[model samples]
Target: MDHRPPTIKEIARQLNVSVSTVSRALSDHPRIGLQTRLRVQQLARELNYEPNTQAIFFKQKKTYVIGVVLPFIREEFFSQAISGMETAAMAHEYTILFGQSYDDTERERKVVAAMKKQRVDGLIISLAKETRRFDHLQALESTGTPVVYFDRVPPFAEAHKVYCNMYQGTAELVGWLYGRGYKRVALINGPEKMPASRERLNGYIEGVSRKKHKVDMQLVETTDFSRDSTYRAMEKLLSLKHPPVAIISFNDYVHMDAVQYAHRQGVAVNKDIVFVSYANLPITSYTAFPPIASIEQYPYGQGEKAMDLLIQVLNEKGLPDAGTRYYCEELAPTLVMH
Candidate 1:
């Protein structure tokens, strides 16, 4: 009446052989004779016997499972990135343990702790928006569990990371806008504490300088990425004596919010005020006012590369220089015109 799956011990008992003989025969060991191997295999198939992968993994000290933590799963960018991670993991006979931080540092810490408790082979993470301290991630590396970060990575240089180089793309966007005779440009950036915000600001400055335009702080605004905050930023820009003809947003989400606010004020999107942003997401196409152009950050490539890097780290764990090794990749963002 027992419903449990047949085990090696049961197989051995049925064949009147030792457990080692059954195990060796199932593995096609050379020491086991042909007849015994065939008999054990036939019985295994008939009884629906399956190898206990958990026991094998325990003996090997490897789970063949990786943890992936991102800020938000609903965001198309993160979803595409995870898809790339999944594809790469499958090619290596591994699988992902997925978690979402919802942009909260506390939630990210809890998810990471849970993954560690599960003893994942390694971890790939895109940091939460509010994560400033990396002690939690550092603890994992100290325990010999490799961690690779992608997209929203930490500011440190010692960590393994893969990310998009947005500076060049943002600069290119400025030059592109200038070419179209939109000399007065502005930017709607994210929280000042974020590294991404700094990258976009630097690029905006460089772009303006390249066109012989003086950097104007009055034209720039920072938003918390909330709808009300985006509306306030839009209002500030519109109140300028000479408003910018083109505005570069932090990302597609911010662009959507800013565009909606602009519409309420009768500002013609892509005409009276042209808008451009990053993360060339497909969802933007359906928005009432999509950006005239966007920077392709290649989230999928970032995710794949991050996973591949983590796998490499896991492979080289015991090597002499593995402890000192670090991998950092910065993919150049491309500006895509809509």
Candidate 2:
């Protein structure tokens, strides 16, 4: 009449063997004979016995869980990154706990605090657009919990990071535009507070300077990476005394706003505007008015590499030596032209 799951002790009693023998057999310990281990495993399977993860975690002082914090998962890049993380975590018998901040700094703080409360072994994070401070992340690291930041990483140098080379990507895109005879290029950038945004802006400036083109401050527009903000920015850019012959968007999602506005205004994209941006989703290729080209950031690869580095950090015992250099892996972005 009992509905409780069978325990190792019950399995031992049923097999008429010592508890240690049953435990060793279940674990496939080399000390246990093959025949006996097989018998114990078969019987354990028959009983639908599941190992107690809580007990195992307690014994080893490990949760075997990694927490992932992101701005949001609706974006294709973050979702693909999570897929990569899941693959790597599964291979090592670890699980992932996910949290989305929705680009809200307060919400991000709460999500990170909750993850800490859960006693996660490690953390992978992409900072929120509004997160200007690193106190929350620094507090976690001070507790000896390893953190790996990707995509929208902070200015912190001590923590591990995995990110795309946005500076190079932006520079190459701008140079290509100029080479194609597009002289006046406008940049619809994300918030200036973000390091990636600053890198892209710097690249834009450098590219223009390299081409001996005049840098027009009016051509640069900053936004919060919102649909409404991007649409408004595009409107302002087009209404300029001399609008740009080409435009570089902050990212593909923000570009969608510009595309929609262009459609409503009967403006022919790629031909009329010559848009370019960073995109990893397949949909970017199929869009009726796709950008002239996109920079492939390889979100999945970033996630995989981040997880690998985090696991390695977790395995190393003892505190890191003071002023020790940590790991930073920067992946190159490839240009995919339509």
Candidate 3:
């Protein structure tokens, strides 16, 4: 068995038809008779004929592969997201090439450049915290590849965005804390540039607005969204002029770190101070004293929706000239109490 890629010429020779007829029939051109199309398609499949991608791309002006960009694959959130994307891609008969930027702009630029040369059909991205310049993204889109921004999307990109209801989740957590009779509230947030920080903060502000509970801006500590930074920031916040009666962390990682900080200071959460964290990941539940409350975001569902919408665009051969917007799917987060 010759394992080399089969060509249209071989199929045409075996079927006793001109190469032009074979090509048109194999592509299922409507003008070609159904019987002719079926015969050519059957032979093409039997020969496992995969047209030369470069030439076929020149003809169809599209590639079937998609590029996926994520901030950190090590995080369970992206792990679940990527898994959903892979499942959807398989159903659509499309391939996904992924890159992890580790939250570095320069590293992300390199990956984008390489994928550009690969001629990926489109892009699906969950932005990194350090991604500030939209120029690279614009350049890739200018090449006529559609882009779908998923969780942690660009702050200002008017593109198809699939994201969680962070605000509602945050508000829910904050309301739960107040109901628990925690007067003072503190925040250990992510890097100020990321969009999640703003939304989560907004929810906190809105939730605590009616109550006389004054928001101690001094108690709001920001870190690089890393475990060490979150822990250090929590330590500083706890050593404040007036420690919070209740503290809310950015997500599970922040919750875990803040809990560790409290442990070091001989404080027991839900006893001395109630704690609520967003993104109730599995690891958070396993901790000695998990977050008093958490936001159970749908990472898997988000990934699936992003890829499904992208498939609709891909199967259309190409998206419209003007960029499209797939509105954010509103998913109410689950409130998990530890």
The best candidate in terms of lDDT = 1
Residue 35, model 2: lDDT of 93
What is the C-alpha lDDT profile of model 3 across 116-228, one tens digit per residue?
99888888888878777778878987777777888887777466778887877777777777787776788888888788888888877777775656666787789897778
Using alpha carbons, what is the TM-score of model 2? 0.93
RMSD of each: 1.4, 2.0, 2.9
Model 2: per-residue Cα lDDT at residue 250: 91
Off by over 4 Å in 2: 15-17, 33-39, 319-325
Q: Which portions of model 3 show Cα errors greater than 4 Å?
A: 1-5, 24-55, 313-321, 324-326
Q: Relative to the unseen true structure, what is the C-alpha lDDT of residue 57 in candidate 2, on a scale of 0 to 100?
A: 94
**lDDT per residue (tens digit) for residues 142-253 in model 1:** 9989999998888889999999887788888899999999999999998888888888899999999999889999989999888899889999999999999999999899
Which prediction has the highest TM-score against the true structure? 1
Q: What's the TM-score of every candidate structure?
A: 0.96, 0.93, 0.87
Q: Is candidate 2 or candidate 3 better by lDDT?
A: 2
**Which clashing pairs does model 3 show?**
none
- Give the clash count for each candidate: 0, 0, 0
Judged by TM-score relative to the true structure, which candidate is superior, 2 or 3? Answer: 2
Lowest-sum lDDT 10-residue window in model 3: 317-326
